[model samples]
Target chain A: MNEYYNSAYKPLLAIDCVIFGYEQGELKVLLTRRKQDPYKGAWGLATGFLHFGESLHYAAERVLKKQTGLDRIYMDQLSTFGEVDRDPEARVISLVYYALIKVESQTLETLEKNQAQWFSITALPKLMFDHETMIQMSWGKLRRKSRYQPIGFELLPEKFTLPELQSLYEAIHQKQFDKRNFRKKILATGLLKKLDEKQKGVSKKGAYYYVFEEGKYDELISQGFNFELKSMAFGS
Target chain B: MNEYYNSAYKPLLAIDCVIFGYEQGELKVLLTRRKQDPYKGAWGLATGFLHFGESLHYAAERVLKKQTGLDRIYMDQLSTFGEVDRDPEARVISLVYYALIKVESQTLETLEKNQAQWFSITALPKLMFDHETMIQMSWGKLRRKSRYQPIGFELLPEKFTLPELQSLYEAIHQKQFDKRNFRKKILATGLLKKLDEKQKGVSKKGAYYYVFEEGKYDELISQGFNFELKSMAFGS
Candidate 1:
């Protein structure tokens, strides 16, 4: 590494995971007590230093799994926090990634191992360093991602009704989307396949179930497609 | 700094700027030959290493000023590129920023320094070490920003006709937008202040001149407002 580069300062790179979990109909963020000396015992986003030759995705995934015993989470790079004093201890630059995970009872024991607990985003405890700003920005990023991406698909059934899908979005975004425009904007993306059977259950007129096609969705994103849901826009 | 951190590996941090300049009615990207070896003389986005006490914004601004002799440019963080082998010579993470600069005749000498040249984005020369991907992603980010922000204000006068503004958008986006929809959508944001007088002497009936109020625009963005322009539909 010394022979290859000529930079005077090598900042320690760390990956901080803002793990958002949908549990019991609430949006929660996972945090733990930092075991390091600078802000020891203070709550901070679950973070891990990156090793040489490690990809950022792998580093973030490794941290999420080690902290919560979860895998295969949906992750997106929110932003990089590189203020010189963001970390009081060292010149550390954090590459923050927001991950969407569904919390379940089964992982309670594993989460407790590292003193990691899920707290409602609305009522989070005091955080360490710039963790608070990172979390705040993650919310905006999450909202933006929800516009075109299937944000809650991991927590939804493979085949779900439009109403059920809208409910998940409303929970994550904390707003109600108009039923008519929500359906129209989502269908406009052409990523959902209309199933032949209608949803069975609570009412005489059951809404039809739709399956979100991942392959088509990926193509849309690749082409820089923008999907706009007019009524009850995100944060409206 | 050692008292603050306990990481074994310190990743060198660098800032690569995808400087987007609108010149001669075309979107151009600024690139220069890599001053350092392994890929010396290969075209790459203008880059600079971060100093220990410098903020990321300052570092990026400094690089931009040094490369093009321009200041007061609008900048945004696009993303961080940190693959294991993104830089063959070393393990370095590049915090990429995209800047919008209006190219003019007066700064030609400064741009010629260090062999920096403005290449049309569509006909970019082969770039070195993931710089091409950095530019590609900047386009998406810029497009999204243009939907809500004043993307071409620096190039236009404080008071300009709707046609002048629309022509700038079509040039930057490389496509045409519907006249009626563009006017309606822009006016809907309320960021544009309608001036009392219309354009003079061009024709029997001249278009009204609207002033884009930056103070109002900033307020709207602070509230996490998502502005949508329905007509022309951006990339549609």
Candidate 2:
């Protein structure tokens, strides 16, 4: 083993999170104002350097918790960004992670203190560095992953109505869907269990709530199932 | 600008290319023996440090060209691997890019000089660091991406038969697809233009050769047409 080659070619590693949440009828991303320079005060994705004695997931989770005070949130690795001067200050490489969390979760207050804000996808501000591009890529990823995977459920409350579910898909998809067709396709998948309860907040004809039937979806997916919603019939 | 908060941190960034090709009815990944140490002689993904002023895509192309003497390949960013000690030699953050190329296009002489070899996914040897895991992840990515994207075409010859196309999918999917439905769904996408010519190498009942309708696919994709291969009639 050449010790010189081992020691000489050290590369820096960091992780950045593209935290997403749905609230107020729009798709929004969680971002923070950088408190440091080179790009100090510029709004960027919630990110940090990887620490010793931790896995990449743990490090990302730590950054999420520290920045948002949210624990056990839905997070997944997105990609790694490593252009040599992507950081300008150095050869910093970022392992980007994407997260979808309930908007009403308790983490909002902590994020507020840290200058974290949620910007609607259609109305995003100019972000620092390549963060805007990161968000855009994350959106494309979310749209793709949400279809085959049961991740759309992550954007909704544990108990949600059919209309709410459709809207969640609409927001993520950025297109309208026919209610009946959407319901038919979703129910046909056998991945949503209709609860005996109704949503009390909005109606005389109250909408029934449902929870994800994860087991059935998993079984079907193992048998090679694809969840597709892109169609003229669904009002795309 | 609070320089104090950011002045101390500088990091290194590296790029790892997950170059994949199809040959002998199997999907293979390009692996190189680490010439320099830390893990000298250990097998790893064909990777290199990102140089200044080059884009990520350029870096990926450079890595591929250096190893295979191949250019203009179908490549995209897969994900970043940023475990703190993912590189035991350094805090290197690796942005993993995946490339799909025709197995026959890359000459063996170039790879021999570069000490790189293509290994079947199923028969891979022990790799350094997280490369084995990276390769597995890239395989999953290929499976997923190939299902909805026109990427499998990258692994096929410029012109190929329906059987050849199906074989490529099966190699990546590792499953038997119903031939009738597979052909129907793929042809229906309008991304494969049937040539008048037939491949007469195997049988008298020659199969028609088809070329990837790249121009049409690109135009349609821009106009929001999706390419997917899931079918209800596929296995039923």
DockQ (C-alpha based) per candidate is: 0.58, 0.43
**Comparing to the true complex, what docking class would candidate 2 get?**
acceptable
Tell me the docking grade of candidate 1: medium
Q: Compute fnat per model.
A: 0.74, 0.41
What candidate 2 keeps of the native contacts, as a fraction, is 0.41
Sliding window of 10 residues with minimal summed lDDT for model 2 chain B: B1-10
Which 10-residue span in candidate 1 chain B carries the lowest summed lDDT? B227-236
TM agreement with the true structure for every prediction: 0.86, 0.89
lDDT by residue for model 1 (B163-210), tens: 878877777677898888888777878878889989998778998998
Best by TM-score: 2
Worst lDDT run of 10 residues, candidate 2 chain A, spans A1-10
For model 2, the stretches where C-alpha displacement exceeds 4 angstroms are: A1-12, A83-91, A107-111, A213-236, B1-12, B52-54, B84-88, B232-236
Q: How close to the true structure is residue B205 of candidate 2, measured as C-alpha lDDT?
A: 94
- Can you write out model 2's per-residue Cα lDDT over A1-236, one digit (the tens) per residue? 24543433444567788988887568888888988778789989988877656667898999888877878988888777766667776666667889988777736566678898888988898888788888998999898777767788887878999899888888888888877788888787778899999988698899999999878878888887766554522363
